[model samples]
Target: MSTDTNTVTALPMRPVVADVLREAADADPRLVVLGADGQALAAGVRERYPERYIDVGIAEANLVGVASGLARAGRRVVVCAMAPFLVRRAAEQIRNDVANPGLDVTFVGVGGGLSYGTLGPTHHCPEDLGFFSALPHTRVYCPADVVDAAWAVRQALAVPGPAYVRLGARADRVVHAPDERFDAGTGLLMRPPGRALAVAAGAGVGIALDAADRLAGPGHTLGVLALTAVTPFPQERVRELAAGVDAVVVVEEHLASSGLGAATALALAGQWHGAFAAHSVHTGYPPIGDREELLAHYRITAGDVAASVLDAVRGPGAGARR
Candidate 1:
Protein backbone atom coordinates (compact mmCIF):
# COMPACT_ATOMS: atom_id res chain seq x y z
CA MET A 1 0.00 0.00 0.00
CA SER A 2 1.34 3.40 -0.99
CA THR A 3 1.13 6.25 1.47
CA ASP A 4 -1.00 9.14 0.30
CA THR A 5 0.34 12.69 0.53
CA ASN A 6 -1.35 14.50 3.41
CA THR A 7 -3.07 17.69 2.20
CA VAL A 8 -3.25 19.30 5.60
CA THR A 9 -0.85 22.04 6.69
CA ALA A 10 2.45 21.03 8.29
CA LEU A 11 3.24 22.94 11.46
CA PRO A 12 6.69 23.40 12.99
CA MET A 13 6.44 21.49 16.22
CA ARG A 14 9.45 22.90 18.07
CA PRO A 15 8.78 26.56 17.26
CA VAL A 16 5.28 26.18 18.67
CA VAL A 17 6.72 26.38 22.18
CA ALA A 18 7.99 29.91 21.45
CA ASP A 19 4.59 31.06 20.18
CA VAL A 20 2.61 29.54 23.06
CA LEU A 21 5.18 30.66 25.62
CA ARG A 22 5.12 34.22 24.35
CA GLU A 23 1.36 34.40 24.74
CA ALA A 24 1.36 32.70 28.11
CA ALA A 25 4.20 34.94 29.39
CA ASP A 26 2.46 38.16 28.35
CA ALA A 27 -0.44 37.42 30.67
CA ASP A 28 1.50 35.93 33.54
CA PRO A 29 4.48 37.90 34.76
CA ARG A 30 5.52 34.92 36.87
CA LEU A 31 6.40 32.80 33.83
CA VAL A 32 10.06 31.94 32.99
CA VAL A 33 11.57 29.87 30.14
CA LEU A 34 14.83 27.94 30.55
CA GLY A 35 16.86 26.50 27.71
CA ALA A 36 19.51 23.76 27.94
CA ASP A 37 21.32 23.68 24.60
CA GLY A 38 17.91 24.42 23.07
CA GLN A 39 17.83 28.05 21.93
CA ALA A 40 15.44 27.19 19.10
CA LEU A 41 12.79 26.10 21.58
CA ALA A 42 12.62 29.62 23.01
CA ALA A 43 12.69 31.61 19.76
CA GLY A 44 9.71 33.96 20.04
CA VAL A 45 9.37 34.27 23.79
CA ARG A 46 13.05 34.97 24.35
CA GLU A 47 12.90 37.93 21.98
CA ARG A 48 10.00 39.62 23.72
CA TYR A 49 10.68 38.73 27.34
CA PRO A 50 14.44 38.39 27.48
CA GLU A 51 14.38 38.85 31.21
CA ARG A 52 12.03 35.93 31.66
CA TYR A 53 14.17 33.60 29.51
CA ILE A 54 17.41 32.02 30.68
CA ASP A 55 19.87 29.92 28.75
CA VAL A 56 21.56 27.50 31.13
CA GLY A 57 24.04 26.22 28.53
CA ILE A 58 24.31 22.44 28.04
CA ALA A 59 24.05 21.52 31.71
CA GLU A 60 20.85 19.45 31.80
CA ALA A 61 20.97 18.75 35.53
CA ASN A 62 21.61 22.40 36.35
CA LEU A 63 18.73 23.36 34.04
CA VAL A 64 16.26 21.32 36.08
CA GLY A 65 17.65 22.64 39.33
CA VAL A 66 17.31 26.28 38.26
CA ALA A 67 13.79 25.67 36.96
CA SER A 68 12.82 24.02 40.22
CA GLY A 69 14.21 26.93 42.19
CA LEU A 70 12.24 29.39 40.10
CA ALA A 71 9.08 27.36 40.57
CA ARG A 72 9.68 27.42 44.29
CA ALA A 73 9.84 31.19 44.16
CA GLY A 74 6.23 31.41 42.94
CA ARG A 75 7.08 31.46 39.23
CA ARG A 76 5.81 29.32 36.38
CA VAL A 77 8.89 27.53 35.00
CA VAL A 78 9.32 25.76 31.66
CA VAL A 79 12.55 24.00 30.72
CA CYS A 80 13.32 23.33 27.05
CA ALA A 81 16.02 20.81 26.00
CA MET A 82 16.83 17.74 23.97
CA ALA A 83 14.79 14.72 25.17
CA PRO A 84 17.62 12.31 25.89
CA PHE A 85 19.68 14.71 27.98
CA LEU A 86 16.68 16.20 29.74
CA VAL A 87 15.16 12.85 30.63
CA ARG A 88 18.37 10.85 31.15
CA ARG A 89 21.11 13.17 32.42
CA ALA A 90 18.75 15.13 34.63
CA ALA A 91 16.79 12.14 35.89
CA GLU A 92 18.07 12.50 39.45
CA GLN A 93 17.44 16.25 39.67
CA ILE A 94 14.07 15.95 37.97
CA ARG A 95 13.01 13.26 40.40
CA ASN A 96 14.38 14.89 43.55
CA ASP A 97 13.90 18.60 42.81
CA VAL A 98 10.96 18.85 40.44
CA ALA A 99 8.72 15.77 40.61
CA ASN A 100 9.29 14.83 44.24
CA PRO A 101 7.87 18.04 45.71
CA GLY A 102 5.29 18.30 42.92
CA LEU A 103 6.56 21.63 41.61
CA ASP A 104 4.78 23.30 38.64
CA VAL A 105 7.53 22.85 36.02
CA THR A 106 6.81 21.94 32.42
CA PHE A 107 9.67 20.36 30.46
CA VAL A 108 9.59 20.54 26.64
CA GLY A 109 11.69 17.78 25.07
CA VAL A 110 12.39 18.28 21.35
CA GLY A 111 13.79 15.72 18.92
CA GLY A 112 11.96 12.93 20.67
CA GLY A 113 12.30 9.26 19.66
CA LEU A 114 14.23 8.88 16.39
CA SER A 115 13.62 12.41 15.23
CA TYR A 116 17.31 13.19 15.69
CA GLY A 117 17.86 11.03 12.61
CA THR A 118 21.53 10.22 11.89
CA LEU A 119 22.48 11.68 15.27
CA GLY A 120 22.56 8.00 16.35
CA PRO A 121 21.47 6.14 19.47
CA THR A 122 23.10 8.59 21.86
CA HIS A 123 20.57 11.26 20.88
CA HIS A 124 17.56 9.00 20.42
CA CYS A 125 15.05 9.13 23.30
CA PRO A 126 12.68 6.20 22.88
CA GLU A 127 12.62 5.58 26.64
CA ASP A 128 11.41 9.02 27.72
CA LEU A 129 7.71 8.14 27.94
CA GLY A 130 8.46 5.19 30.19
CA PHE A 131 10.62 7.26 32.54
CA PHE A 132 8.06 10.06 32.83
CA SER A 133 5.11 7.72 33.27
CA ALA A 134 6.85 5.93 36.11
CA LEU A 135 7.59 9.16 37.98
CA PRO A 136 5.06 10.33 40.56
CA HIS A 137 3.25 13.63 39.93
CA THR A 138 4.49 13.68 36.34
CA ARG A 139 2.37 13.92 33.17
CA VAL A 140 3.44 12.89 29.66
CA TYR A 141 2.38 14.29 26.24
CA CYS A 142 3.48 13.45 22.70
CA PRO A 143 1.70 16.01 20.52
CA ALA A 144 1.26 15.12 16.82
CA ASP A 145 0.73 18.63 15.42
CA VAL A 146 0.99 22.34 16.15
CA VAL A 147 -2.50 22.63 17.58
CA ASP A 148 -1.94 19.74 19.93
CA ALA A 149 1.55 21.10 20.72
CA ALA A 150 0.12 24.47 21.72
CA TRP A 151 -2.65 22.86 23.73
CA ALA A 152 -0.15 20.64 25.51
CA VAL A 153 2.02 23.61 26.48
CA ARG A 154 -0.96 25.57 27.76
CA GLN A 155 -2.31 22.60 29.67
CA ALA A 156 1.10 21.81 31.11
CA LEU A 157 1.63 25.36 32.36
CA ALA A 158 -1.88 25.72 33.70
CA VAL A 159 -1.86 22.55 35.79
CA PRO A 160 0.28 21.88 38.84
CA GLY A 161 3.23 19.46 39.12
CA PRO A 162 5.87 18.57 36.50
CA ALA A 163 4.95 17.61 32.91
CA TYR A 164 6.77 16.41 29.79
CA VAL A 165 5.83 17.33 26.19
CA ARG A 166 7.71 15.54 23.41
CA LEU A 167 8.22 16.91 19.90
CA GLY A 168 9.92 15.79 16.69
CA ALA A 169 12.76 17.64 14.96
CA ARG A 170 10.93 18.76 11.83
CA ALA A 171 7.43 19.99 11.09
CA ASP A 172 4.40 17.77 11.72
CA ARG A 173 1.37 17.30 9.48
CA VAL A 174 -1.68 18.93 11.03
CA VAL A 175 -3.75 16.13 12.56
CA HIS A 176 -6.48 18.35 14.01
CA ALA A 177 -8.43 21.15 12.38
CA PRO A 178 -7.71 24.70 13.52
CA ASP A 179 -9.02 25.42 17.04
CA GLU A 180 -10.25 21.87 17.60
CA ARG A 181 -11.50 21.29 21.11
CA PHE A 182 -8.94 19.11 22.94
CA ASP A 183 -8.40 18.03 26.53
CA ALA A 184 -5.86 15.86 28.31
CA GLY A 185 -6.30 12.04 28.28
CA THR A 186 -8.99 12.14 25.57
CA GLY A 187 -8.54 10.46 22.19
CA LEU A 188 -9.42 12.67 19.21
CA LEU A 189 -11.38 10.84 16.51
CA MET A 190 -9.86 11.53 13.10
CA ARG A 191 -12.28 9.32 11.19
CA PRO A 192 -15.83 7.98 11.51
CA PRO A 193 -16.59 5.02 13.76
CA GLY A 194 -15.50 1.64 12.39
CA ARG A 195 -15.12 -1.98 13.45
CA ALA A 196 -11.31 -1.68 13.29
CA LEU A 197 -9.56 1.02 15.29
CA ALA A 198 -6.04 2.46 14.76
CA VAL A 199 -4.66 4.26 17.81
CA ALA A 200 -1.51 6.34 17.43
CA ALA A 201 0.49 9.05 19.12
CA GLY A 202 3.12 11.63 18.02
CA ALA A 203 4.25 11.16 14.40
CA GLY A 204 2.41 7.86 14.15
CA VAL A 205 -0.92 9.68 14.06
CA GLY A 206 -0.26 11.00 10.56
CA ILE A 207 0.82 7.55 9.38
CA ALA A 208 -2.28 6.07 10.97
CA LEU A 209 -4.45 8.60 9.14
CA ASP A 210 -2.89 7.61 5.82
CA ALA A 211 -3.38 3.92 6.70
CA ALA A 212 -7.06 4.55 7.36
CA ASP A 213 -7.38 6.13 3.91
CA ARG A 214 -5.63 3.16 2.28
CA LEU A 215 -8.01 0.66 3.94
CA ALA A 216 -11.12 2.61 2.97
CA GLY A 217 -11.90 1.29 -0.54
CA PRO A 218 -11.60 -2.42 0.27
CA GLY A 219 -14.67 -2.71 2.55
CA HIS A 220 -12.43 -1.84 5.49
CA THR A 221 -13.72 0.85 7.77
CA LEU A 222 -10.86 1.74 10.10
CA GLY A 223 -11.33 4.43 12.74
CA VAL A 224 -8.28 6.54 13.70
CA LEU A 225 -7.63 7.70 17.28
CA ALA A 226 -4.98 10.39 17.95
CA LEU A 227 -3.81 10.57 21.55
CA THR A 228 -1.40 13.24 22.89
CA ALA A 229 -1.47 12.19 26.53
CA VAL A 230 0.29 8.96 27.51
CA THR A 231 0.79 9.02 31.27
CA PRO A 232 -2.38 9.31 33.29
CA PHE A 233 -3.41 6.83 30.62
CA PRO A 234 -7.02 7.31 29.57
CA GLN A 235 -8.43 3.88 30.35
CA GLU A 236 -12.07 5.00 30.32
CA ARG A 237 -11.66 6.80 26.98
CA VAL A 238 -9.91 3.79 25.40
CA ARG A 239 -12.79 1.58 26.54
CA GLU A 240 -15.26 4.10 25.12
CA LEU A 241 -13.45 4.35 21.78
CA ALA A 242 -13.03 0.58 21.42
CA ALA A 243 -16.77 0.06 21.90
CA GLY A 244 -17.59 -2.09 18.85
CA VAL A 245 -14.23 -2.47 17.16
CA ASP A 246 -13.26 -6.08 16.62
CA ALA A 247 -9.54 -5.35 16.45
CA VAL A 248 -7.31 -2.46 17.62
CA VAL A 249 -3.77 -1.53 16.53
CA VAL A 250 -1.48 0.92 18.34
CA VAL A 251 1.23 2.77 16.39
CA GLU A 252 4.01 4.76 18.07
CA GLU A 253 7.58 5.91 17.31
CA HIS A 254 8.91 4.74 20.68
CA LEU A 255 9.77 1.24 21.78
CA ALA A 256 6.87 -1.24 22.02
CA SER A 257 8.01 -2.33 25.50
CA SER A 258 7.60 1.11 27.13
CA GLY A 259 5.62 3.50 24.95
CA LEU A 260 1.96 3.94 23.98
CA GLY A 261 1.79 0.30 22.93
CA ALA A 262 2.38 -0.80 26.51
CA ALA A 263 0.12 1.89 27.95
CA THR A 264 -2.85 0.94 25.74
CA ALA A 265 -2.38 -2.78 26.42
CA LEU A 266 -2.28 -2.13 30.17
CA ALA A 267 -5.45 -0.07 29.87
CA LEU A 268 -7.44 -2.64 27.86
CA ALA A 269 -6.05 -5.72 29.64
CA GLY A 270 -9.17 -7.23 31.24
CA GLN A 271 -11.83 -4.73 30.17
CA TRP A 272 -11.81 -5.55 26.44
CA HIS A 273 -11.27 -9.02 24.97
CA GLY A 274 -10.54 -8.74 21.27
CA ALA A 275 -7.74 -8.87 18.74
CA PHE A 276 -4.94 -6.39 19.55
CA ALA A 277 -1.62 -5.49 17.92
CA ALA A 278 1.06 -2.87 18.57
CA HIS A 279 3.40 -1.48 15.88
CA SER A 280 6.38 0.26 17.51
CA VAL A 281 10.14 0.67 17.26
CA HIS A 282 12.14 -2.47 17.97
CA THR A 283 14.21 -2.91 21.12
CA GLY A 284 18.00 -2.13 21.09
CA TYR A 285 19.84 0.68 19.32
CA PRO A 286 18.33 1.79 16.02
CA PRO A 287 20.45 1.66 12.86
CA ILE A 288 22.08 5.00 11.94
CA GLY A 289 19.94 6.64 9.21
CA ASP A 290 17.61 9.53 8.44
CA ARG A 291 14.20 9.75 10.04
CA GLU A 292 12.26 8.38 7.03
CA GLU A 293 14.75 5.58 6.48
CA LEU A 294 14.62 4.56 10.15
CA LEU A 295 10.82 4.57 10.15
CA ALA A 296 10.68 2.27 7.10
CA HIS A 297 13.41 0.06 8.54
CA TYR A 298 11.41 -0.37 11.74
CA ARG A 299 8.25 -1.15 9.73
CA ILE A 300 6.26 1.64 11.38
CA THR A 301 5.08 3.37 8.23
CA ALA A 302 1.54 3.73 6.85
CA GLY A 303 1.90 0.53 4.87
CA ASP A 304 3.18 -1.36 7.92
CA VAL A 305 0.40 -0.08 10.18
CA ALA A 306 -2.28 -0.77 7.58
CA ALA A 307 -0.95 -4.28 7.01
CA SER A 308 -0.90 -5.03 10.72
CA VAL A 309 -4.49 -3.84 11.19
CA LEU A 310 -5.66 -5.95 8.26
CA ASP A 311 -3.92 -9.02 9.65
CA ALA A 312 -5.49 -8.48 13.06
CA VAL A 313 -9.02 -7.86 11.78
CA ARG A 314 -9.14 -10.24 8.79
CA GLY A 315 -6.48 -12.84 9.67
CA PRO A 316 -2.99 -13.63 8.29
CA GLY A 317 -3.04 -13.31 4.50
CA ALA A 318 -5.49 -10.42 4.31
CA GLY A 319 -2.77 -7.72 4.18
CA ALA A 320 -0.14 -9.63 2.18
CA ARG A 321 -0.06 -7.06 -0.60
CA ARG A 322 0.26 -4.15 1.82
Candidate 2:
Protein backbone atom coordinates (compact mmCIF):
# COMPACT_ATOMS: atom_id res chain seq x y z
CA MET A 1 0.00 0.00 0.00
CA SER A 2 1.03 3.59 -0.56
CA THR A 3 2.59 4.78 2.66
CA ASP A 4 2.46 8.51 1.94
CA THR A 5 -0.35 9.80 4.15
CA ASN A 6 -1.11 13.34 2.98
CA THR A 7 -2.95 14.50 6.07
CA VAL A 8 -3.30 17.82 7.82
CA THR A 9 -4.15 18.98 11.34
CA ALA A 10 -7.83 19.13 10.60
CA LEU A 11 -10.43 18.04 13.18
CA PRO A 12 -11.13 14.34 13.84
CA MET A 13 -12.98 14.84 10.54
CA ARG A 14 -16.58 13.74 10.79
CA PRO A 15 -16.64 12.46 7.18
CA VAL A 16 -19.28 15.07 6.46
CA VAL A 17 -20.33 15.57 2.84
CA ALA A 18 -20.36 19.27 3.45
CA ASP A 19 -16.71 19.12 4.47
CA VAL A 20 -15.92 17.63 1.09
CA LEU A 21 -18.07 20.25 -0.64
CA ARG A 22 -16.50 23.01 1.40
CA GLU A 23 -13.08 21.73 0.44
CA ALA A 24 -14.06 21.57 -3.22
CA ALA A 25 -15.69 25.02 -3.23
CA ASP A 26 -12.57 26.51 -1.69
CA ALA A 27 -10.57 25.63 -4.81
CA ASP A 28 -13.11 25.93 -7.62
CA PRO A 29 -14.70 29.22 -8.72
CA ARG A 30 -17.28 28.00 -11.21
CA LEU A 31 -19.21 25.96 -8.63
CA VAL A 32 -22.83 26.92 -7.89
CA VAL A 33 -24.54 24.79 -5.20
CA LEU A 34 -28.30 24.16 -5.10
CA GLY A 35 -30.05 22.59 -2.13
CA ALA A 36 -33.33 22.56 -0.18
CA ASP A 37 -31.87 23.02 3.27
CA GLY A 38 -30.00 20.18 5.02
CA GLN A 39 -28.31 18.92 8.17
CA ALA A 40 -26.31 21.45 10.16
CA LEU A 41 -23.04 19.78 9.16
CA ALA A 42 -23.86 20.88 5.60
CA ALA A 43 -24.52 24.48 6.62
CA GLY A 44 -20.85 25.33 6.38
CA VAL A 45 -21.13 25.47 2.61
CA ARG A 46 -23.99 27.94 3.00
CA GLU A 47 -21.93 30.03 5.38
CA ARG A 48 -18.67 29.94 3.42
CA TYR A 49 -19.91 30.10 -0.15
CA PRO A 50 -22.93 32.33 0.38
CA GLU A 51 -23.12 33.69 -3.18
CA ARG A 52 -22.79 30.25 -4.73
CA TYR A 53 -25.01 28.41 -2.22
CA ILE A 54 -28.71 28.37 -3.08
CA ASP A 55 -31.64 27.10 -1.09
CA VAL A 56 -34.10 25.98 -3.78
CA GLY A 57 -36.97 25.71 -1.27
CA ILE A 58 -37.73 21.98 -1.47
CA ALA A 59 -38.45 22.02 -5.20
CA GLU A 60 -36.59 18.97 -6.51
CA ALA A 61 -37.39 19.26 -10.23
CA ASN A 62 -36.38 22.87 -10.34
CA LEU A 63 -33.25 21.92 -8.49
CA VAL A 64 -32.01 19.82 -11.42
CA GLY A 65 -33.41 21.96 -14.22
CA VAL A 66 -31.87 25.09 -12.79
CA ALA A 67 -28.57 23.30 -12.50
CA SER A 68 -28.82 22.15 -16.10
CA GLY A 69 -29.44 25.74 -17.16
CA LEU A 70 -26.53 26.94 -15.09
CA ALA A 71 -24.21 24.41 -16.72
CA ARG A 72 -25.33 25.50 -20.17
CA ALA A 73 -24.64 29.09 -19.15
CA GLY A 74 -20.98 28.19 -18.47
CA ARG A 75 -21.17 27.36 -14.78
CA ARG A 76 -19.88 24.11 -13.35
CA VAL A 77 -22.86 23.52 -11.12
CA VAL A 78 -23.97 20.88 -8.62
CA VAL A 79 -27.53 20.01 -7.55
CA CYS A 80 -27.36 19.18 -3.86
CA ALA A 81 -30.27 17.84 -1.80
CA MET A 82 -31.62 14.86 0.11
CA ALA A 83 -31.23 11.70 -1.95
CA PRO A 84 -34.82 10.44 -2.18
CA PHE A 85 -36.54 13.64 -3.28
CA LEU A 86 -33.64 15.00 -5.27
CA VAL A 87 -33.31 11.78 -7.29
CA ARG A 88 -36.88 10.57 -7.70
CA ARG A 89 -38.55 13.95 -8.19
CA ALA A 90 -35.87 15.42 -10.43
CA ALA A 91 -35.03 12.30 -12.43
CA GLU A 92 -37.04 13.57 -15.38
CA GLN A 93 -35.22 16.86 -15.40
CA ILE A 94 -31.95 15.01 -15.01
CA ARG A 95 -32.69 12.74 -17.94
CA ASN A 96 -34.07 15.41 -20.24
CA ASP A 97 -31.59 18.18 -19.60
CA VAL A 98 -28.36 17.38 -17.78
CA ALA A 99 -27.72 13.78 -18.83
CA ASN A 100 -29.11 13.93 -22.36
CA PRO A 101 -27.10 16.97 -23.31
CA GLY A 102 -24.03 15.76 -21.43
CA LEU A 103 -24.07 19.00 -19.49
CA ASP A 104 -21.19 19.72 -17.11
CA VAL A 105 -23.28 19.38 -14.02
CA THR A 106 -23.18 17.10 -10.98
CA PHE A 107 -25.48 15.87 -8.25
CA VAL A 108 -24.06 15.58 -4.72
CA GLY A 109 -26.67 13.39 -3.07
CA VAL A 110 -26.58 13.23 0.73
CA GLY A 111 -27.98 10.50 3.01
CA GLY A 112 -27.64 7.78 0.40
CA GLY A 113 -29.13 4.35 1.19
CA LEU A 114 -30.39 3.72 4.73
CA SER A 115 -28.15 6.35 6.18
CA TYR A 116 -31.36 8.17 6.99
CA GLY A 117 -32.21 5.23 9.26
CA THR A 118 -35.37 6.10 11.23
CA LEU A 119 -36.75 8.06 8.26
CA GLY A 120 -37.81 4.66 6.82
CA PRO A 121 -37.54 3.15 3.34
CA THR A 122 -39.15 6.16 1.70
CA HIS A 123 -35.82 7.95 2.19
CA HIS A 124 -33.63 4.96 1.39
CA CYS A 125 -31.39 5.50 -1.67
CA PRO A 126 -30.90 1.91 -2.72
CA GLU A 127 -31.59 2.58 -6.40
CA ASP A 128 -29.68 5.80 -6.94
CA LEU A 129 -26.61 4.00 -8.32
CA GLY A 130 -28.69 1.95 -10.74
CA PHE A 131 -30.57 5.05 -11.81
CA PHE A 132 -27.44 7.11 -12.35
CA SER A 133 -25.62 4.27 -14.09
CA ALA A 134 -28.43 3.95 -16.63
CA LEU A 135 -28.49 7.63 -17.53
CA PRO A 136 -26.47 8.80 -20.51
CA HIS A 137 -23.24 10.60 -19.80
CA THR A 138 -23.77 10.03 -16.08
CA ARG A 139 -20.84 8.98 -13.88
CA VAL A 140 -21.48 8.02 -10.26
CA TYR A 141 -18.95 7.96 -7.42
CA CYS A 142 -19.82 6.87 -3.89
CA PRO A 143 -16.76 7.52 -1.74
CA ALA A 144 -15.95 4.76 0.71
CA ASP A 145 -13.90 7.08 2.94
CA VAL A 146 -13.47 10.70 3.94
CA VAL A 147 -10.36 11.26 1.80
CA ASP A 148 -12.03 9.81 -1.26
CA ALA A 149 -15.17 11.84 -0.56
CA ALA A 150 -13.31 15.14 -0.58
CA TRP A 151 -11.21 14.11 -3.56
CA ALA A 152 -14.22 12.80 -5.50
CA VAL A 153 -16.11 16.06 -5.01
CA ARG A 154 -13.22 17.94 -6.55
CA GLN A 155 -12.80 15.50 -9.44
CA ALA A 156 -16.51 15.55 -10.30
CA LEU A 157 -16.42 19.34 -10.32
CA ALA A 158 -13.58 19.18 -12.82
CA VAL A 159 -15.19 16.67 -15.17
CA PRO A 160 -17.73 17.68 -17.73
CA GLY A 161 -21.18 16.13 -18.06
CA PRO A 162 -23.51 14.81 -15.37
CA ALA A 163 -21.85 13.07 -12.40
CA TYR A 164 -23.46 11.76 -9.22
CA VAL A 165 -21.72 11.28 -5.86
CA ARG A 166 -23.11 9.72 -2.66
CA LEU A 167 -22.58 11.18 0.78
CA GLY A 168 -23.56 9.37 3.95
CA ALA A 169 -25.73 11.02 6.64
CA ARG A 170 -23.46 10.78 9.65
CA ALA A 171 -19.92 11.68 10.68
CA ASP A 172 -18.52 8.46 9.26
CA ARG A 173 -15.04 6.95 9.34
CA VAL A 174 -12.05 7.92 7.24
CA VAL A 175 -11.21 4.87 5.16
CA HIS A 176 -7.88 6.15 3.93
CA ALA A 177 -5.31 8.84 4.47
CA PRO A 178 -5.43 12.24 2.70
CA ASP A 179 -2.85 11.56 -0.01
CA GLU A 180 -4.32 8.40 -1.46
CA ARG A 181 -4.95 9.06 -5.13
CA PHE A 182 -8.40 8.38 -6.67
CA ASP A 183 -9.97 8.98 -10.05
CA ALA A 184 -13.00 8.00 -12.03
CA GLY A 185 -13.30 4.21 -12.59
CA THR A 186 -10.80 3.30 -9.88
CA GLY A 187 -11.01 1.35 -6.60
CA LEU A 188 -9.00 1.06 -3.38
CA LEU A 189 -7.85 -2.03 -1.57
CA MET A 190 -8.60 -1.02 2.00
CA ARG A 191 -7.03 -4.06 3.60
CA PRO A 192 -3.98 -6.32 3.34
CA PRO A 193 -3.88 -9.18 0.86
CA GLY A 194 -4.13 -13.00 0.47
CA ARG A 195 -7.83 -12.91 1.30
CA ALA A 196 -11.18 -12.70 -0.32
CA LEU A 197 -12.04 -9.12 -1.27
CA ALA A 198 -15.38 -7.64 -0.32
CA VAL A 199 -15.81 -5.24 -3.22
CA ALA A 200 -18.08 -2.54 -1.82
CA ALA A 201 -18.95 1.15 -1.83
CA GLY A 202 -20.14 3.99 0.44
CA ALA A 203 -21.05 2.98 3.97
CA GLY A 204 -20.89 -0.58 2.73
CA VAL A 205 -17.11 -0.43 3.12
CA GLY A 206 -17.55 0.02 6.85
CA ILE A 207 -19.89 -2.95 6.97
CA ALA A 208 -17.51 -5.13 4.97
CA LEU A 209 -14.61 -4.10 7.17
CA ASP A 210 -16.59 -5.11 10.23
CA ALA A 211 -17.46 -8.40 8.60
CA ALA A 212 -13.83 -9.01 7.67
CA ASP A 213 -12.57 -8.31 11.18
CA ARG A 214 -15.14 -10.54 12.81
CA LEU A 215 -14.98 -13.36 10.27
CA ALA A 216 -11.19 -13.77 10.16
CA GLY A 217 -9.64 -16.98 11.60
CA PRO A 218 -8.87 -20.64 10.69
CA GLY A 219 -7.68 -20.23 7.11
CA HIS A 220 -9.59 -17.08 6.11
CA THR A 221 -8.75 -13.44 5.62
CA LEU A 222 -11.58 -11.20 4.49
CA GLY A 223 -10.15 -8.15 2.80
CA VAL A 224 -12.00 -4.88 2.26
CA LEU A 225 -12.02 -3.48 -1.27
CA ALA A 226 -13.40 0.02 -1.56
CA LEU A 227 -14.81 1.25 -4.86
CA THR A 228 -15.60 4.93 -4.60
CA ALA A 229 -16.26 5.48 -8.30
CA VAL A 230 -19.20 3.53 -9.67
CA THR A 231 -20.41 4.51 -13.13
CA PRO A 232 -18.21 3.77 -16.15
CA PHE A 233 -17.27 0.88 -13.84
CA PRO A 234 -13.50 0.56 -13.48
CA GLN A 235 -13.34 -2.46 -15.75
CA GLU A 236 -9.60 -2.85 -16.27
CA ARG A 237 -8.51 -2.17 -12.70
CA VAL A 238 -11.28 -4.31 -11.23
CA ARG A 239 -10.42 -7.12 -13.63
CA GLU A 240 -6.81 -6.98 -12.56
CA LEU A 241 -7.78 -7.44 -8.92
CA ALA A 242 -10.47 -10.01 -9.65
CA ALA A 243 -8.00 -12.05 -11.65
CA GLY A 244 -5.87 -12.63 -8.56
CA VAL A 245 -8.25 -13.04 -5.65
CA ASP A 246 -9.64 -16.46 -4.78
CA ALA A 247 -13.09 -15.04 -4.11
CA VAL A 248 -14.96 -11.78 -4.43
CA VAL A 249 -17.78 -11.03 -1.97
CA VAL A 250 -19.66 -7.97 -3.15
CA VAL A 251 -21.60 -5.94 -0.57
CA GLU A 252 -23.53 -2.75 -1.05
CA GLU A 253 -26.17 -0.73 0.74
CA HIS A 254 -28.11 -0.66 -2.52
CA LEU A 255 -30.20 -3.18 -4.41
CA ALA A 256 -28.76 -6.61 -5.13
CA SER A 257 -29.22 -6.68 -8.90
CA SER A 258 -27.69 -3.41 -10.10
CA GLY A 259 -25.35 -2.62 -7.24
CA LEU A 260 -21.56 -3.15 -7.17
CA GLY A 261 -21.90 -6.91 -7.05
CA ALA A 262 -23.68 -7.04 -10.37
CA ALA A 263 -21.25 -4.59 -11.87
CA THR A 264 -18.24 -6.60 -10.72
CA ALA A 265 -19.76 -9.88 -11.90
CA LEU A 266 -20.35 -8.53 -15.38
CA ALA A 267 -16.79 -7.23 -15.57
CA LEU A 268 -15.35 -10.53 -14.43
CA ALA A 269 -17.44 -12.67 -16.75
CA GLY A 270 -17.34 -10.41 -19.78
CA GLN A 271 -13.91 -8.87 -19.37
CA TRP A 272 -11.87 -11.10 -17.06
CA HIS A 273 -13.46 -14.41 -18.05
CA GLY A 274 -13.44 -15.53 -14.43
CA ALA A 275 -15.97 -17.00 -12.06
CA PHE A 276 -16.09 -17.16 -8.31
CA ALA A 277 -17.29 -20.10 -6.25
CA ALA A 278 -21.03 -20.47 -5.75
CA HIS A 279 -20.44 -19.29 -2.20
CA SER A 280 -20.15 -15.71 -3.48
CA VAL A 281 -23.08 -13.62 -2.22
CA HIS A 282 -24.65 -10.18 -2.65
CA THR A 283 -26.66 -7.99 -0.28
CA GLY A 284 -29.88 -6.18 -1.12
CA TYR A 285 -32.21 -4.13 1.04
CA PRO A 286 -32.19 -5.69 4.48
CA PRO A 287 -34.84 -5.85 7.19
CA ILE A 288 -35.50 -2.14 7.78
CA GLY A 289 -34.08 -0.32 10.78
CA ASP A 290 -31.32 2.16 11.66
CA ARG A 291 -28.07 1.78 9.70
CA GLU A 292 -26.33 -0.19 12.44
CA GLU A 293 -29.39 -2.30 13.13
CA LEU A 294 -29.95 -2.94 9.45
CA LEU A 295 -26.32 -3.97 8.88
CA ALA A 296 -26.35 -6.32 11.85
CA HIS A 297 -29.71 -7.85 10.99
CA TYR A 298 -28.54 -8.50 7.44
CA ARG A 299 -25.15 -9.91 8.49
CA ILE A 300 -23.24 -7.16 6.67
CA THR A 301 -20.85 -6.18 9.42
CA ALA A 302 -17.07 -6.84 9.23
CA GLY A 303 -17.67 -9.94 11.30
CA ASP A 304 -20.20 -11.03 8.75
CA VAL A 305 -17.84 -10.46 5.84
CA ALA A 306 -15.12 -12.40 7.64
CA ALA A 307 -17.59 -15.14 8.36
CA SER A 308 -18.50 -15.34 4.70
CA VAL A 309 -14.83 -15.63 3.83
CA LEU A 310 -14.39 -18.38 6.39
CA ASP A 311 -17.38 -20.23 5.05
CA ALA A 312 -16.02 -19.92 1.53
CA VAL A 313 -12.65 -21.29 2.60
CA ARG A 314 -13.43 -24.03 5.13
CA GLY A 315 -17.06 -24.24 6.25
CA PRO A 316 -19.26 -26.93 4.68
CA GLY A 317 -20.82 -24.18 2.63
CA ALA A 318 -17.28 -23.21 1.53
CA GLY A 319 -16.74 -26.64 -0.18
CA ALA A 320 -13.22 -27.98 -0.95
CA ARG A 321 -10.47 -25.43 -0.22
CA ARG A 322 -7.39 -27.76 -0.09
Off by over 4 Å in 2: 1-28, 39-45, 215-218, 270-288, 315-322
Displacement of the residue 136 alpha carbon in candidate 2, Å: 1.4
* Tens digit of per-residue lDDT, candidate 1, span 102-121: 99999999888888889888
lDDT, residue 176, model 2: 70
Which stretches of candidate 1 lie above 4 Å from their native place?
Answer: 1-3, 6-8, 316-322
lDDT tens per residue, model 2, 100-125: 99998878887787778777778877
Model 1 lDDT, residue 132, Cα:
84
Top-lDDT structure, candidate number: 1
Each model's lDDT comes to 0.84, 0.71
